[model samples]
Target: MSSTRTTETNGAEPTYKRRRTQRSPSPQYKLDDDDTYEPYISVAQRKQAKLAKLTSWGAGSDKDKANKLKEEEEERQDEEREEERRKERARKERTLLMEAQEVHERKAVEDSKKTETEKAEEHDAEILAAIASRRKLASDLELAQGVQYTEPVKTSWRPPRFIRERTSEQHRRLREKYHIIVEGDDIPPPIENFTDMKVPEPLIKFLKSKRITKPTPIQLQGIPTAFAGRDMIGIAFTGSGKTLAFCLPLVMVALEEESKLPFVRGEGPVGVVLCPSRELATQTYENVLQWTASIAKEGKYPQLNTLLCIGGISMNDQSHVMNKGLHIVVATPGRLIDMLEKKRFTFDHCKYLCMDEADRMIDLGFEDDVRNIMSFFKHQRQTLLFSATMPRKIQDFAQLSLVKPILVNVGRAGAANLDVLQVVEYVKQEAKMVYLLECLQKTPPPVIIFSENKNEVDDIQEYLLLKGVEAVAIHGSKTQEERQYAIKSFKSGAKDVMVASSVASKGLDFNDIQHVIIFSMPKEIEDYVHQIGRTGRSGKTGIATTFVNMNTPEQTLLDLKYLLMEAGQKVPPFLTSIEDPRAAQGGSLTGCPVCGGLGHGISNCPKLEDTQRRQMASHRVSDDRGGY
Candidate 1:
């Protein structure tokens, strides 16, 4: 046979018969007619018709081949994805193993470097802090055992059902007019005038003689509550007659006791008043004296003895007064606690307890002492707590002490006086002294300059006196005599300016004070309010100028802005533009309600934090580690 097979030249072959490779796919059916000769048309019409019924021999075979190729491609793709997943898992496993080895090596090195004793010490330090914190917690729990609080409620307190001279609509209008917010149970409606206050005619004559015919917002609400035989808390701005509110009721109750019985020597005080500072105690004592003056030997009423038991004054004098069987005792917490502990006088006949500047008492670290004083009273006495600002720190004491107290909060609690013109100026710390000269010129004489501390008070007083400003300084360091002399001089026009610390800011009434200059702003905004309040007293308008610098705290600035805005004062651009997390609550609340701190919340209160840490530590140790 030739190399190329000879076949028919018509169509199936390329003119001559071509040999096919064995790898070529076999046809579905035999080409029966052409197998022996050459590749013919590949489909003889006769042969194709014979196998036509079998579609697999024709178009069906091509379709089957295409489906097989597609299946193979899909299988290959699945295998590739599976391989990628396996590789990723292997990579992760290797990384984990490498990390574990490194960690083990690091631990080995660390263990080698540290001695057993050193490690034990470190561990012990942490454990001790924990133990100390736990002790404080246990102590608080002990204090909390069966302890009661007035406790904040969402609803406002309703007035007690009593005989009222004024109509209910008139009472509603009066409360709304003065922005008085009342809370607690059995609250009595406020009075419209001083005539509505049912007291001895002698005290009424005294108020009339003093030209005080109308009752202030606090007096209207507070006096009635006290008269209703209920415990009460009075929160109002300074110079808003907070003193008269409690003082009037105090005098009335004392007179009532005096009317029923006569006092015997070495008997007891029927009423007791606690003040934070010696000056406040002295002033309150004077106010009580003025009210009692009508009921004393001078007036037609019976002689009612009121004693001022303050420090720097003779305890012998106080003892003598107590021995005479006083009607009322007004003394600072420190001296009062001492007097009570020494058995100088007993509250056996005491039916009234009035605490003025309650927040200051807590701040001065006299909360425990106040509690101790309360412990001396075996029977329930009518407790009255009055503060310009009611901080949350004092809330515990209020709750623990007062039983079902009526909270007569006038205006916004702890808000600065809107009537006082507040002026904020930027002055560097070093340049404050130089600028103070110009500030003194802003208002007339009878001005008060508040310093941050005693040392600063001395320095400012010296500078002002050297400049011939007729200034006098008062602070805790000064004896009661010196402080009284300074206050008298400032009030009598003997001294034009009174440079004092926060000790004088609480409840000292300076008549006709036109201006107050803050040499350096206090750390707290609440103090700032009280400092400025020194000038605006007894329903008169006043001015306050404060010096602030870049070094001043940002949170304080934020608080100051809100206070100024609340009082309708102009806020400086620098203060308004400032921002802080502490004021993220958008100034709805003036300062932190708990601690009166502008920089933090109740949860983050530094005072509470200390208590929290102490509660956690073993034996209540002093450390930063908080209780568990």
Candidate 2:
């Protein structure tokens, strides 16, 4: 046979072939032959040979057995280690559980011994007792006389006829300038200046030093009324100089009384100023100190004494001050009540009682506490109530607390400041954050962002911080120190934005605030007015931007629209067209048809169940009679 084969190329068809085969070689009986035979071995036989090579009996007999035994020992050791590790883990878990149970049981036992109210009461008692212990009674001689020192009686004198005529002319000018309305017989005329108001020479000099030459409308009216020794309710816009309006009269009266019959130690303060918040009390106290210092110069009125009695400070320190002596006490209702109850001080000699931010005090449910404090005064002291707005509740309170008070409404009650350029933007609730960010970019620094609650305030503050905005927050939950620091930081230009709750709505005087942003509409219209009032103060123009959404209460929106219109600001069509969501959803005043109850519908009525049962019973009785 041919050894080569011919193949077709490309498209050619012819081909030739030759078979190629080789004969098997004969096996050789030699060691070299073993190597050759191994390549030809079957898979099963080859695997058998590999197993034999690896077995102890096949190679290095004793050494292989020793290696196998060593591996077995290692396996046993590893198993023991794993078992030990699992047991240790179980032991640790058990120990932790036991510790937790012990801690829980101890807490449970302690909790069972006393209720939360009892624990709080006990803590309060300890604090009060400590304060009482620190308090020292007045010297026998001082208490017996009931005055610091007796002064010769000076004959009371009235203003000269020319001064009275000038005062009348000034009053007319003030009424026209501030649009002030006064109602009551013998209404005192507003003063032309602090000098005409009969403010002490020292205070007038102090005011001049501070460059406060003119009197704000509230001061012009409120000061004269307060000086006349009549209960007065002064209503003015926030930052319209209400603090000085009431404080000037207070200091004047206290100084005059101090000259005649000074307060002795433990005789209690001659004047008590109640504020709604600790911050307000502190602010008022600082202002009072400034005024007192002006009058309390060396050898001037025997160094008039004042003290701040507020919470979050050591009561013992306050007690020590009270024991030393305090002519004036500025305090919150709760702390003042606590001091009065503990006898750290008395209201027996309290000749003047002023409720600053009286509307807020009443809103916080301090009406009863205020009433209790008033009971201590027995209505003999002059009560001066000052607020930014005059709600009906406030009017009711004034009726009960004041004796025919002269209602001094600076502008319309609960109306926002005319100076503020109010703008309303209709936005979705979810898009408020984005809108706020956009607003901040355009608005200048020294902005105040008012949130509806503390949590929102914190959230907005944190978001601003994340966006590299210099911001601080003030709310009721913050300590007094934190609140003070935040306000100071904002005032010093260290912070640009302040996120606050309604805690900052009353009596906080941020003079240079350029913008007020309402992150959420307040539940009350008065609060909205106050929030915006934070800006446009002290004769400076400001902008107030409010974000309104459908989720906002319909009544709040309506009230806001009315307020905006009253302020002569343009209202958006969306705000005008917004209907109450609840009403649109078929909510009605119809009563339950089954029971005529207002709360529920017929489907869920308890009476319906009984009625159905009775109807079924009647049907069964009718079927039985028909069968008979």
Candidate 3:
């Protein structure tokens, strides 16, 4: 045993068997295991033994045990809060050195990663430039091939000289074909004439400020019923003051309940307006603000707080605003849901809910969001569903939202404000731009050319400007500030022509829009109604033209026919001939014998391409594949 004194492995330190040079006198409770040979220990001795055991294990062992104990202590700090204050001095000292080292090491790693990221970006840029160069060469080669080899051109076709111009009688018949008629005599005037109706003065004032001297037939009927606290499903032609119908009631009801405050007014939104698109939401908000602001100016009205909660805005700002109350909020469904989840706003106190362009809201697949929002309201709120035309799907939403709503239609195929002169012209696809130029040269000022896509909108605007026409384009891709400037310029008579997409379709209040050119046929009949609606607004008469081709799909034509016919317009005999090429004009929905109700013949209907569509698709595909 004397020759076998214990030593540490590798480093030759004292081991378990080694004896201390000096040992304290054993306590009365000390055990053999507790010390070198004691078998029992006191509570104080045990605590000391634990501390010593931790220290003796390793340098890091003591630190880790201290950290774990500190974490446990922190967890119990609330119960031991007084004791935590007593131990604060030691607590700070224990973590101070480690925290500093960790911070320095973290910063060093971040700097290294940043340098690597910048280098990678530089490398990618060079590779992308090389790829672009190859794409450009390919496009050049294709253009050269097309120029070098050309097929014999087909003979240009011309229309019969007998159809040079349509007589007023022919125009009337065409309108009849589409069931477009001004049946003012048949449909009773909306009780707009009733002076004693309990309609709110604020709404009446709003209408006046907008320079609306009279309500459209739908508004006349719908407003009074809504004012009576009745739910309403209003079916009317587009541009017939439907917005005012629903908006007026919403504003009035909201203003009625809002708490008044001076200077630092709190937000207490009593009404909410939901729309499909941001453009529509913004337009509706502006309209509401214009009238509401005027009311505030009179010093009699509370500063009605109207907030906009649409997507594509700063979320942080939206969250902050939601914490504060709002008097009225105009929002698209998506952003409103996000805010609701984040507890930014509540619809609990919503006394009035308006779905402007209800058909569009449904068409855009917002029904589920709308339904979820409706559940948030406990009591049945005054609901209004406004649409240009009532499709089956929209009808379902209306029935669900409104509680026995009064159905109001101006007339059969509801007259789309007779002020709009709708005409259709046939043209070749390649010649569309030239035809547009011709129209500009011949048509009067303040014209709007509507395209379905932004690229086309930009192209048309640029082409028109190149031809020395003062035109500006507005689309979703443009910044809100840019859209506002363009709209202001157009309205101020500074710009003569505005090339636009569907962004200019709904609720945009632009006065003196004289003519609307369908640069491309709108996708839906309801959209078509709204597109032309822009022209003949606020009791102003306007002209609208749509270019149709023989290549226009029979289904599209039929849809157009049904849309017009539903509106009480008569279908053209030629359109009827589409279903029966050989049969005389008959009002029968015979299965198109061509493609067995597929709307095309086996050969022609299955894969038919109109001249313009084919050209546009080819050009678009080429541009995309050529990496333009």
- TM-score of every model versus the real structure: 0.70, 0.65, 0.59
**lDDT, residue 536, model 1:** 74
Query: Which lDDT tens digits does candidate 2 get at residues 1-628?
Result: 5466566778687676676678899977787646555446795796577567777355567877788678669978999999999998988778777979999999789879985555544554454343223111122333345423222112233343565676656766768887888766567777667766666778788888877888888887778777777678888887788888888766766677678876677765778888988878888998889988877774566556778888888777656566665688898888888878888878777777888888666542565577567656532567788887766434554654455568888886677798999989888988988789898865679999999878999999999999999999999899978998998899889999999999888877875788899999875666788899988987788899998887786656766766777778998898778563334445543333322233333344344455457668978999999997
lDDT, candidate 2, equals 0.73
How many clashing pairs does model 1 include? 14
Against the reference, the lDDT scores of all candidates come to 0.74, 0.73, 0.63
Off by over 4 Å in 1: 1-170, 297-299, 318-320, 582-591, 597-600, 603-628
How many residue-pair clashes does candidate 3 contain?
24
Candidate that beats the other on TM-score, 1 or 2, i.e. the better one:
1
Residue 390, model 2: Cα distance from true site in angstroms: 1.3
Tell me the lDDT of model 3 at 81.
82
Give the Cα error of residue 296 in candidate 3, in Å: 2.8
**Worst window of 10 by summed lDDT in candidate 2:** 131-140
